[model samples]
Each structure stands twice: as structure tokens, then as C-alpha cells.
Target: MNRLAYHQGIHKFFMMLGLALHISKPVWKHLVHLVDALTTKRFSGTLTDVHHWSFHPNHRTTLSHFFTKSPWNEERLLEKLQEWVLRQIERLAKRTNQPLFLSIDDTICQKTKPSSRATHVIQGCDWHYSHKDHQMVWGHSLIWLMVHTFTQAFPFAFRLYDKKAETSKMDLAIEMLSSLKGKRARPVYVLMDSWYPSRNSSKPA
Candidate 1:
């Protein structure tokens, strides 16, 4: 199915759930349209279907503008979304005997243009011969904590680390571990590469 149809279907499904009655149906639909446009690869467009709902032709709407106009506060929305996701996960976990596995890893995405938002990010030391270019390039790595159960994988946390940063990947791992310490479904094991060895690391595997 096309992205627009898929997104429209999802919005309809969520509306049927009746979580909160305070939000207007039109507004909720617009929010869903905006979110799908921003996050999904298949739904790429500068102007969203939201433009169709607006009467003024000259006005253009962006994701940032949608958020600003949204009645639901960002923090509360995030918290509620997280709670719903966790509930769904717990339901699935109860159906299986296997324990959840958490994996931590970092990756670098090389960018040609520098970002004003990239200040204080550390530069990378030459770890290996560059495959993309002959010369070494400054790279920033981001650490992510992901959980795997029998049927699904959930990403719980992410942190960015530069080579010149004071904190190490180990530090980021520790932070991720600390964050998950008291979860209802405690992870059975944490998997990591040789860069994070079991012998020397303070975090449990």
C-alpha cells in the first residue's frame, strides 16, 4: 500500500481506541498526517495532506508548526506513548517464556556538510583505512540500547559520542544500563562487541 493510505488507516485505527476525548478529531488527524510525513521514508513531501485542510493557500505548514499548534504537550505525549508501547511489549512477553535481550552498539554516519548543531562534538581518530575516501574523516558515533523479545525489537535509548568527548562508549553503555536497571521486565543479557569486553567492564553482560 502507498504511504498515505497506510498512514490514513493507522490514524483511523488509533481514533477508534478512544484514549482521550479532549483532542478534536480534525486536529488529531492533522497531527498524524504531519508525523507520518516527517518520519516515514515513503511519505516524503514538502507540503503534507494537511495543506488540503487549510483554507488559506498562501499559508504553509511544517512539522515544527504542527507541534507548536498541537494541544497535547510534547512531554506528556511522549510519556503516554512510551507507556502504551511498554504495555504492548509486556503482553507479548507474557505469551513467551524467553527473556528479553538488550544489545548496545554505536555507528558513525559520515556527513559532507558541517552542522551548527554539531559544536563540541569530538573528532574521530583513524581506526581503519577509509573505504569511502582515501583520507581519514572526523566521525561521530551514537550509542543505542535496543531490546529484543521473541517477536519484536524495541529501541529504548540513544546517546551520541565523539572521539574527542570526555565520556567514552563505556560511559554511554553504563548510562544505558543504569536507565534499564529497574524495569518491570529486567533484561536477561546485554550483548556487546569486543570493544566492550566482559572482563574489564563494570557493567554486567
Candidate 2:
């Protein structure tokens, strides 16, 4: 299908961004197909070979490679997204008098199977204790920081939580909060769950 033509509105917006400049044509083609498949409610399966022929000439293997072992800098893309989101927020903040709410949370995303390819190959996929599931699940641990205005909650900065990484979630939250040192919203209030508290017992949540 000519998804670009089919979804011209979204396609034009994506193309207009400086973010689109970095992607090569072949990679961009697969990326667009993946976006189309993912956003559609009916085609909700893993981007594997089952739906490969339905879209275009590229195989599922090619698409999988674009996610993993690909040379693309997803971090840079995220930074671009951050830039774009803040610009939108700036427009809305001028109209609202509410203090911006910066919320932080972490969740466990369980894998299909313990030893599945996703658990092995996907970045940040691992064993984590899921309080929601009440089990040790093999999958990704994800943490995100979101900005909540009166009408919207925009999840902007997200990072994979790996205990093997450089720092703890507490540290990362602090770092993320620090990044908003001089936001247009004054006195940004941080809303975190019970899990996050000062290590010292004497302090309040």
C-alpha cells in the first residue's frame, strides 16, 4: 500500500521535521510501514514475517534489523521529540495558570515468554519484579518522566531501567528534574509514587 499517500497528514508532518533528514530512504521506508502497522488497531501483532507480504517488498528480518543492530541513533531521535514537545507545551503554558506537574513512574513490561527473542535481544529487556503482576517477569523495566498540564499529560523523557546501568532510578529522576531547572512553568511539582522516597526515613514523601 502507498501508506505515505494514505496517511498524508502524518507523513507530511514527519517529513517536515529536521528529524527526518537523518534517516536514509530504505530505512525510512520500513520505518513508515512499521508506524502504519503499529498505529492501526487491526494489525496488532509483532512486526514479524506474518504481515511482511501484506505491506511491501521488505522482509520482516529487514524491519527487525532496523530496530536492533541498526546504526540509527534513537537517542538523538528522542532529543528531537523532546524539542518538538516542549515547543508545543510553550504555546499552551501561556494560556494556563496551573503549575506544571512533573510525574515519574516505572513499570514492568513482561515478555511473551521468559526465553523469548525479545528478552534476549531487545535493549533493557530483563528480569524484574513486577508489583502489578506479583511475579518475577522477564522483560523490560521502563521509567518515564511526564509533564502534566491542565488538559494533557505529555510523556517526554523515557529511559530503560537497568540495574546494571550507571545509576539508580532515584538518581535518574533527580537528573531529569534537574533538566527542567528553568521551565516556563514556575514551581514545578514532582508527583512520584510511594516507591520513591528519600533513603532517609525521617524525611517526608
Candidate 3:
């Protein structure tokens, strides 16, 4: 598709998505610009990068505040997204007689070590052992859950692994799974790495 047509198509898609999610039109307009910037090839996932790449006239600060200060409830958005994905996949899985699959994994987003003199470092960033690198890495950690059928996959849910929080990685994994309880009619096979198959996790769900 031509650039203009592609942009228009994306705009319409997000409009329909926003309506389904019950986002106010004004918030959806700004949200669409942010989403547009995110989908761009050269755009990095940052407020500054989003503002630079987006076609909207809003300043960078406005974009930042749109997240930090906006009254919109992100939890609501996520819940709606998960509900929509479940509906589509559940329908398709039944039609194709495909058993659903759920996978859980965690990853570390490594960031530069903050200077010793720096008083305020990024919140929720800490040193965590990287199984891939076999060493401690300083960054935020995240755990994600994805659901899939034979032909398609969806990011069902995720949780940031906060060391300071009361929850363990296993607890977070179980929590994400718990949210999906009683929501699916199809048989789902849960998949995880060797690290996740502990005594607690080995128990029948």
C-alpha cells in the first residue's frame, strides 16, 4: 500500500481498537500517534523517539505526560486486550480442533550501569543473574505469558519482576496463569524452560 493509504489504514484500525477498549476519543487520538511511532521501522521505544517520529504536533513533554500523568487506566486496556485475544483464539481453536498453548518466559533488559555519583537511578532496575550471559546484569526484568494456537500467537499477559516486591518469579508466573483461569474452553498445554519446572510448578494446575 502507498504510505498515505497505509497510514490511514492503521489509523482506522486503532480507532476501532480504541472503541472496543472504551478509550475516550481525545485520549485515543494521542494514543494513536504513540502507537504509530511504535510501529515505525526506525523508531526506538522511548518518549523522545516517539515524539520525534510521530506525525502529531504535540511536544515531547506532552507525550511523556500522556503516560505519566494521564488518567487512563492501563490495567483496563490490558484486560480488554486479553479478552479480545482470547475470544478470537478460542473461536479459531474450536474451528480447527487445535489445542491451545501457553508459554511463560522471563528476560532481562540490560541497561548501562549508573554512575556512582548519580543520586537517582531508574526505578525498578537492579542487578539480576542472566542465565544467557551467565553473569549478573543491571537492568529491569520482565516475565511474559503468551497463548497460541497452531497458526497464531498472542501476548496474553506480563509482569515486571520486581525484586523489592513481595512476589517471586514463580509467584508472578502463577499469578499470570491464575488470571486466565476458567477463561478458556480448549485444552491448553503449558510450556516453560527447565528453570521453571520446580517442585512447586510441577504440581498439577
Candidate 4:
């Protein structure tokens, strides 16, 4: 089967298992389209099509709209996704009899201009030597935490920190660890690069 079909099948299965409800089939289909667009890096086309298709007469309103208009929040959806991921990891741990490894790192998504929505304001710094430009350019920093899955060799669980804040990447890593704590029987080993080495700037974890 094709990728789109596989995604649709999984969506149907989840719906049948009662894990996804209150979301119409059409909205779900659009959401799958959105995911495909994101995966394929077709951002402009996807945004245009989503905006056009969403307002059509036959298209149903998305869950995001309802939640924003009503009292519902994203916490429940996030919790469900987390639970599903943990369950999958548990199954893998039982099958392999090995501990799970998580990697934490941070990078800069450089932006030339500032926006009002950005939070945690902090001064930009240049961590790399630009040989081509002969000068370093300051940019905002982003921290991420990743998990290595049994099905995939690479790390997942990447979180982006776009805001300019005083919070250390270590703090974010600890929060992610705390969330996954007690969720598995096997051990979890977190790896970090030299940028995240034990430092006086932040207390040891």
C-alpha cells in the first residue's frame, strides 16, 4: 500500500479502537493531507490548499477551531499521544530486553527579524566559527530532546525552543525525563553533546 493509504488505514483503525472520536472523517482526511505536506516539505502548497479546502462548504471544521472557540485544551491530546508512544516503547523493551536511549541537544534556527509572539527574550550568541563569512552571526537557540526507538535507529522526541529565554537546555531535558519517569520498567539513558556538558551555568542533573 501507498503511504497515504497506510496513514488512512491507521487513522481508521485508531477510530475503530475509540482512540479518536469527535473528529469527522473529512477533517481527519485533511489532517492526513496536512501531515503528508509537512513530511514532504511542501509548506507553501500545503498551507494554500489547507486554507482553501478548510473553508469550503463540504469541508468540516477542524478540531483546532473548536478547541479555540470552546473551553477545550490541547493537554488531553498531548497526553494521549504521549501514552501511545510510551506503550509502543514498552512493547519494544519487552521484546528486545534492552534499555531505551534518549539524546538531548540544542540548535539555532536563525531568524533575521524579531516578532512579537516570541517569548523568553535573551541575547543571541555565535557558537560557531564562520570560515566563509569570517565573522559570526548571532541567532536564537533551540533545545531538543530525542528518543531512539526500536523500529528506528535514529532519535525522536525533538522539541524546538524558539523563544529567547534564560532557561537552560538542561532544564528542558530534565522536564522531558520527568515526564517519562516511571512509565517504563527498563532503564533510560540520556546522551548529550559537549555543549551540554556539566557546567556551573546550570546545576548538575
Candidate 5:
């Protein structure tokens, strides 16, 4: 295929992802542009970078507004994404007669410590231990659940570790896993480090 056709195909695939979610046409249009920009080779991973790489006619400010004020429901989008991913992975597992894998892990999104004089810091930013840095760092911790097969993997869900909620990372992991209780079509294994498997969490629920 020619370069333009290949790019168009990729964008079309992204557009199809939201079709089942019942999002507005404008939101769908913006989503394709954003996905295209993000998946571009050498993407710098910023909205401005998206503006530079995107072929859509909307201005960067319009894209920014889409994020801040768009009527699309993010939770619905995630739910539909999970539904689509589950369908795909289940088909692969059943076809190959392979067991599915559910992997749970947490990572810190490091952030700069605000100055004492500063009135407010980013909401949800706090100190979290980073195994990679081997020290406590100021950031938000995210718990992620991924589904893996012998051939491929997909991020299934995620939760931000909320300190004020009085919920531990293990609890968040369990909650996400619980969401998959009756959803799997094959034998599934849960993978995690020693840090997450408590007496309660270790048991099959």
C-alpha cells in the first residue's frame, strides 16, 4: 500500500474502535486525529506534538477543547474498550487453546514537588515509592491490569491509587480483577509481584 493509504487505514481502524461506544461524530473525528498523532512514528507524546503531526483540520486549541469540554463519556469509552479487548483476546485464546493471563502492576507518574509558597499542587499528587528509583518520589501511583496471551497483550484497565480513599493498592488490584469475574472465556492466571499477594488477595475469589 502507498504511505497515504497505510496512514488512512490506521486512522480508520482507530475510528472503528469508537463506533460501538455511541460517541458523537465530532468526538469520533477528534479521537481519530488524536490516535493518529499519538501513534505516529517519533511522536513526542504531547498535545502540541499531536497538533504538529495530525492531518485533521482542527486547530490545536480545538483539540485541547475536545479534551476539556467534549461531551463524550470517558468511562463509557473505557468500558467499551475493555469489552472489545475481551472479545478479541477470548477469541484468540479459544482458537489457540491457550490460557489467558491477567497481570497487575503499579507504576508511579513522577511529578515535581511544588514549592512551599505555592498555594496548590496537582490534585492526587503525593509521595509514592518507586522501585525503579529505589526511593520515595512525589507522584501519582497507577495500578494497571493487562490481559496477555502467548502472542499479544492488551491493557485492560487501570485505577489511580487514592490515598484519601483509604484503599490500598492491593484492594484496587482486587477490585479491577473482580470486574473480570465472569468475563473470561478461558482459564486465567493472575500475575503479580510478591508485594501484592496478601493472605486475602492470594486466595481465588
Candidate 6:
């Protein structure tokens, strides 16, 4: 779950793809270092770690640009990530009898800064009441689709829920399910907490 394990293989995947897509080597290096810092428990989210233990040298300002204004198709990148996830799940399925689980859930990641307010309009960040915190919080409400094969879970897709967009959390889950139809994974049991399950949870009969 930390940088060491992921950097061994996943970083290589990103590097090769970045090269094929004509991404600058620096961008590719930052991509790996960004993920490394984010997943690391030691220096998590600190700018110093992203210079990557002095492995790659760059200013902290670069990360802000990499996250917000990077000229890449996020949706396409996510699709490729999902493809890799599915392939791994399929490989794991061959070794286990456990049924594949497709789970849907969401959370509010509250933003606490004025500059971070950019997410307010652009990335679906807003005030949403949180049962966990017992009050409204300013942040993005993001829902995810993940696949599990008994031993592990892999994130497949995501949707940012904007109240102004009029899409309910349940609706976002259903959209992911619909979009996944005709894919290779089958016999996927839908998993959810009490808040999400309903007679309408599944597609129309």
C-alpha cells in the first residue's frame, strides 16, 4: 500500500504510457513521485516528499500545476487505469473461488483553504451534509466503483457528485453499472451499505 510496492511495477506502467503519449520525462517522473508521496505514510502529501526524497528535484509549485492545469484527459486516464484493474482482477479470479464483488460508495473530502476553493466550481466541491461529521462540510462528494475478488479491491471508476448537477448518489452508482455492462467481468454481486441499497438500486427489470 506504500510507495515501495507500487513504484516497482505500477510506475513502470505509467512511465511507458507517458512516453508513448509524448509526455515529457519530467512529467512522467512527477507522476510517479506524486503517487509515491500520496501513498506514503511517512511524508504523506508534503511537498518535500514529492521532490521525492531528493530522487527527483523540482519546486513544490510544479505539483499544484500537475494536479490542476495538466493537459491530460482525466477521463481517458481513468479508463486505462480501470482496464489494468480489471485485468489484475481477472488474474486473481483464476486463483480463487470467491465471486467478484462490485461495490459502490461515496464520501465528502472537505476543503479547508481559500485557494483550494477552486474545486468549488470546477471539481464539484460544495457544501454537503455529512452523517459522519454531523454537519455540512465544504468539499467534493465523490462516488467510486470498485471490484473485489475476495482478497483485494481495485478502484474502477469515479464520479463527482454536484448537487447543482441534480444527480443523486444512487444515480451515479447506476450510471457506473450501466456503463460497465457487456464488460468481461460477470456474476458481479452488487455490494452496498444500508444507505445505498433499495428496490431501485438495480436497473429496471
Question: Candidate 5: how large is its RMSD?
Answer: 4.0
Sort order, TM-score high to low? 3, 5, 2, 6, 4, 1
Q: Order of all candidates by lDDT, from best down to worst?
A: 5, 3, 6, 2, 1, 4
Lowest summed lDDT across 10 adjacent residues in model 2 is found at: 196-205
Candidate 5 regions off by >4 Å? 1-7, 14-21, 115-120, 181-183, 200-205
Q: What is the C-alpha RMSD of each candidate to the true structure, in Å?
A: 6.8, 4.2, 3.6, 6.4, 4.0, 5.2
Residue by residue across 1-205, what tens digits does model 6's lDDT show? Answer: 2446566665678754444375556566677776666665676556767666524457778877887787756676666677677778877876686678888888777776346445445355678778798888778888888888889998888888877765678888889887675656446788886657676543210
Per-residue lDDT tens digits for candidate 1, residues 7-81, read 767677555545356466555766666665556555434464444432213345544465566566554444455
The residue-by-residue lDDT of candidate 5 on 92-118, one tens digit each, is 999999999999988888888899999
lDDT of 5: 0.81
Model 1 segments more than 4 A misplaced? 1-31, 42-61, 64-78, 113-140, 181-187, 197-205
What's model 6's lDDT at 156? Answer: 85
lDDT of each: 0.60, 0.67, 0.80, 0.54, 0.81, 0.70
TM-score of each: 0.57, 0.77, 0.87, 0.61, 0.83, 0.74
lDDT of 4 by residue, 47-90 (tens): 45544433323333553463245443345545556666666676
State, as a TM-score between 0 and 1, how close model 2 is to the true structure.
0.77
Clashes of 2: 0
Off by over 4 Å in 4: 1-7, 13-30, 44-46, 49-72, 111-140, 149-164, 195-197, 202-205
lDDT of 3: 0.80
Look at candidate 1 and tell me the lDDT of residue 168: 70
Clashing pairs in 2: none
